[model samples]
Target chain A: MGISGAAFIAGAYEHPLRVIPDKSVAQVHAEVAAGALADAGLSFSDVDGYFCAGDAPGMGGIGMADYMGLKLKHTDSTETGGSSYLVHVGHAMEAIHAGKIKVALVTLAGLPRQASANLQMGVTDTPEGGFENVFGPTIHGMYALAAKRHMHEYGTTSEQLAWIRVAASTHAQYNPNAMFQNVVTVEDVINSPMVSDPLHRLDCCVISDGGGAVVIVSPDVAKGLERHSIKVLGHGEAPKHSDNGKIDLTYTGAAWSGPAAFDEAKLTPKDIQYASIYDSFTITVLEQIEDLGFCEKGKGGEFVADGGLISPTGRLPFNTDGGGLTNNHPVNRGGMTKILEAVRQLRGEAHPAVQVPNCELALAHGTGGSIGTRMGSATLVLGRD
Target chain B: MTEATAPVMPAPAPIVNPENKPFWDATVEGRLVLPKCQNCGSINWYPRVFCPECGKFGVDWIDAAGTGTIYTFAITRRGMGAYGKAGPYVLAYVELDEGPRIMTNIVDCDVDSINIGDKVRVVFHDTGSGSALPRFTPVS
Candidate 1:
């Protein structure tokens, strides 16, 4: 029961800003900021805080904020691989609670502009007593391990795992901004080249260059800012890490956190009419729903096989706009899509083809770390009061 | 003085703490041993003093049967760091005949020979130093 103002925008990078630039950072930030402000029906001055996920070149949160011609009251350049933006929202909400700031503009830009075969990118600074990446983990291989673990435990067959791709493509076919909108079936997912064992090429989300932003203000700030407020009903977070020892590759904390958060927000799975789960891999989403109590743990494999969500009328309309698996994965842009879709449903602005009836409350969940051994999850429950 | 760019990670070194010495020692000795709860008799790897099941610190090292099954594996295309040059090698999880899984390399066979649930017999290879790494091979 908290936040108020929120809007989102997405656009292809490497366009328009060619010659006079440092990798099109500023121009890209402005385009997204404008889109967000426009969606919320506000101007730039209303944004006093900034949160960003990308650290490409010399750009961080305040670095981009200053160039956007605004003095940021609060900022976070929090980067934890892919789940940064979703995690940032939890941080921003905490700041809002402190009453130190209002109105934050969050943005992300991870674009691969023409691939080169160079190994060394810029080195990263270790955070204060943060765990090191000594395990030599890749995001892809970790997801493969998770798929295998889920298969080992739940009797979740590889064929059932491929169904996630089928469901995602079916929805993305109606979404133009989606990178791979071609409609495909389960056979396509199975026949696809193996990227990691048990995880085929279609199992992984695409890597695309894009930017997205969302503007959120506190309830007090929202009264004067806009006519409608999609109140943040609840937020929850859980992390998997320890400076010492064995990585247990089972049991997602979200299974516990989802119920805990719903209890706090005074909501239930049934009340959530539409959901946008981070789909870095098809199997991850199935695990999240099972663990989050959308369905029983072993039952998820069957849920997907039964065509649980190919159309709006399906049991639970999930990732209504193509998810990261099919849609544009601007990294942080993935989180923005969910926040934007929730606001659209609350405002009844979702394209009629995939709109839900009375989608009052929405759920957006995000998790990161390639190997499921180290997992971080944040769930957002928002509603139209 | 200027603020210097910081290192993203600490130097990668083999980890050793008070509780893990036995497990590390066994790896160097070419013996696969896991701590079994002497009180409740539960077997587990990556050794610990306290038994997870019985909440007792009576667990002690026992030599495990080297035999296991290839629960799952991947012929890694992208090798990592020093290991990257050893590309297209199989990294597998072996579910031991004694009821525990350990992540180890699967060798002594071609890529086409490995499949899920295939029987594996363990062999230990020395690093020419005091240490050896336990790896498994597909059972004929």
Candidate 2:
């Protein structure tokens, strides 16, 4: 299985906060779907499978299929926060190999910044609300709890966390569509207003209104397409404890998913040329780097602090699209964007500023839900064919 | 001449349902209760219908010691909605002596001075709805 076309759609604004009042969530999804299909030189009729996430008015995937007029043979509406789309890629691959569907279109869109509507997923009625929300732990506070614990257990410094933001911002400088293009230093990130203990305001991902779509096809279908296709080498997904279940706050589902992905891909971390790990928070990237076997446990802070590890010319160029830290978050469905960037990198079409030279293999990883409580993770390995 | 009065603090109220009614009822009396699986001796948090460890329905409520250590914490300088007005508060997970980490708010201590592994004891704050919310304060 391979990805034939990838397209991202959002308002043209460089400011960190802007609302696209005119466009609804469905409108954005339709635009991105058309663009992606066109990129692959295919039409709507060519798509036989549909996958989507996020809370819309009705059933997630059914709503999108109705709005886009996509009559599909297979559908998946898996909702696991930001990592939903990455998991979709794995599901699509399995289904294609089994002859369940020939062409699958995975789409994601949200309007969090729009004043006219609220598209963020509702969490008040969830089990997390019953157990954790009573104490007033904001999403940032939850991730901050992990950061503080990491600092306490591993002697990680706030300076090292700031470096993660610095690396993402540096990559954002080349992405004209990124929310924040100004390069910031470690001091700037550390001195920014504290949203929660150990997490500065700059440590959080920017909220934005955007959407993205990707077209996946079986090898035979991909062979017929004129566009270049990126091979889906292997993938894995895992769910940690439930909302109220006991969890090791330092470890994430990535610990299981990452190794499973690498094993199936038959490749080690050393073979990866580029990475597009989720960046809902700086600690997220740091945790995934260590959990994905890029570094030893508790050595993530030191590994990331090393000069240019995440830079364009560094040992592992990651989040080349600026990531959620600076780029658009689009209702925290960043896994979709992560996949989009990995496809671009393998296609040799990434922006020259953040492109890794001679890039052959790339990894896309996503973490969803609160870090302190329960969450899910998905990892994918893609290669140029 | 008129005088202005202080506004009432706005905090989210805990949702009490059929599955968790007993847990909340016990808190009103200033006792912390958790579900314990008699089959496997595994303590469960968040109140589940069955034992997550043993997958048995022989779970029973047991009184906890109310003493624990801070596993992790965050000082929230900004909050959502009414919580925003109550800035610089400590939100933390306290690992109970019974072997379960529970989410709580740490009170009666400097938010900046709190550290992981700090000993804490449970304290109840009245929610004005006849139910007391369980919070933790450093055990000096």
Candidate 3:
């Protein structure tokens, strides 16, 4: 299984205070789909499989298939919050390996800014609303709980967490489309308004309107194609119990998914040349770095405190596109962007400033939902062939 | 025209579905109850029909000792949506003496003074909807 083509597109609106308010999620998806197909030198007529996170009224894949006039042979609409697309990539790879589909397309798009006026994906009044939502804990607040616990249990400091934001903004300086490019210091991140305890405003990701698409094909189909392809060496996914009563807030599903992915890829954390771990929050990157076996458990703070590990010129470059913290969150769905950056890094087409020299293997990981409660994790190992 | 009014804070109300009705009902009487399994003695929170550990439906509601310790907590300086108007509050996970950790808000004290592993006891607050929601406050 290999990704033959990929495309990332943002709505033509870039105002710091206001949204573009022009394109719908479907419109963004359609454009990204067409662009990705064109990049693959293929057309909608050639797509046999469709996959997407079901964030819209109807299932996203079915709606996309109808909108693009593609008669798909397979469709996957997995909803695992931000990590849904990475999980989709794993599913698409399995289906393609089984000869179920020749060319599979996975797409994601969201318009969080226009959600108020447009068809918003409003939170439904579910059962958990009574238990969890009643207390008014913002999404950041939930993750803050994890950060507090991690600090309490492992002696992690706010300064260490602030460094992740600083690193992200540093990378964003090279990205023209990033939401925030201004370099920030640890003191600046600490001085920022507190959204929740243990997390400053800069510690969280920004909301943006964007979409991305990736075209996956069987190895044979990729071999026949003219464009360069990146092999999907391995992938794994895991779901955590959503009920806060049962979940251990300090740990996440990545503890399971990361090991599974590494085993399947037959590679250790040392083999990775580039990394694209999700950055919905600074603590998220810390947790994943530890759970992915890059460092010892509870040692992520020390591992990331120094700028060299994740800096572009360092041993392991991560989130080269600035990540969600400084780049874009796309309605809190970061898996697509994570995959897009990994592909770009492998193709040697990443932003010149953040490009890892002689990069060959890249790892992209994603986390969805609240880390303090129920969360989903997905890991993918991609390699240049 | 006139200035826009601030949004109303959302009331703390629990959605009492059929599976979790008994738990909410007990909350109204200032009692905390959990589903205890007859087959394996495993206690379940958030209401489940079958025991998670034993996979049996022989689960019964049992009273809980309202004492626990703060497993972790966050002081929300700025809330979101309706909660935005609610002001700073403490959101935390309290690990009950009986074994399950529950999501709750710590109340009746300064939010910044709370610490992990502090002993806490449950206190019921009226939702103004005839139902009460359980919160925790530090115990001396």
Please state the i-RMS of candidate 2.
Answer: 2.7
lDDT of 1 by residue, B44-128 (tens): 6545777766788877798888898876666555545534455455666677888776666677677765667899987765544
Q: Write the per-residue lDDT of candidate 1 for residues A1-385, one digit (tens) a residue.
A: 5433232211112122212224465666677778777766777887777787653335567677667777777878876555666667767777777776777777765444334322211224322011122223345656676677678777888788777778788888877677888988888988988766678889888766566667777766666654466767777777764212334454565775577568767878888888877788888888888877788877888887757865577777777667778876663236555566666666666668778887788877777654444566777777776
**What ranking of all candidate models by DockQ puts the best one first?**
2, 3, 1
Per-residue CA lDDT of model 2 for B1-140, tens digit only, reads 22111123244567677777778888889998988888998888867667777788867889999999999998877666547577567888898998888888888776656779999999887676656667888998
For candidate 3, the per-residue lDDT at B130 reads: 51
Query: Taking the tens digit of each residue's C-alpha lDDT, what string does model 3 give over A330-358?
Result: 76788888988888888888888888877
Please say which candidate is ahead in DockQ: 1 or 3. 3
What lDDT would candidate 3 get against the real structure?
Answer: 0.79
Q: What is the two-chain DockQ of model 1?
A: 0.12
CAPRI class of candidate 1: incorrect
How high is the TM-score of chain B in model 3?
A: 0.87
Cα lDDT for residue A385, candidate 1: 62
* TM-score per candidate: 0.77, 0.93, 0.92
Rank the models by TM-score, top first: 2, 3, 1
Clashing pairs in 3: none
- The local lDDT score (0 to 100) that residue A381 gets in candidate 1 is 79
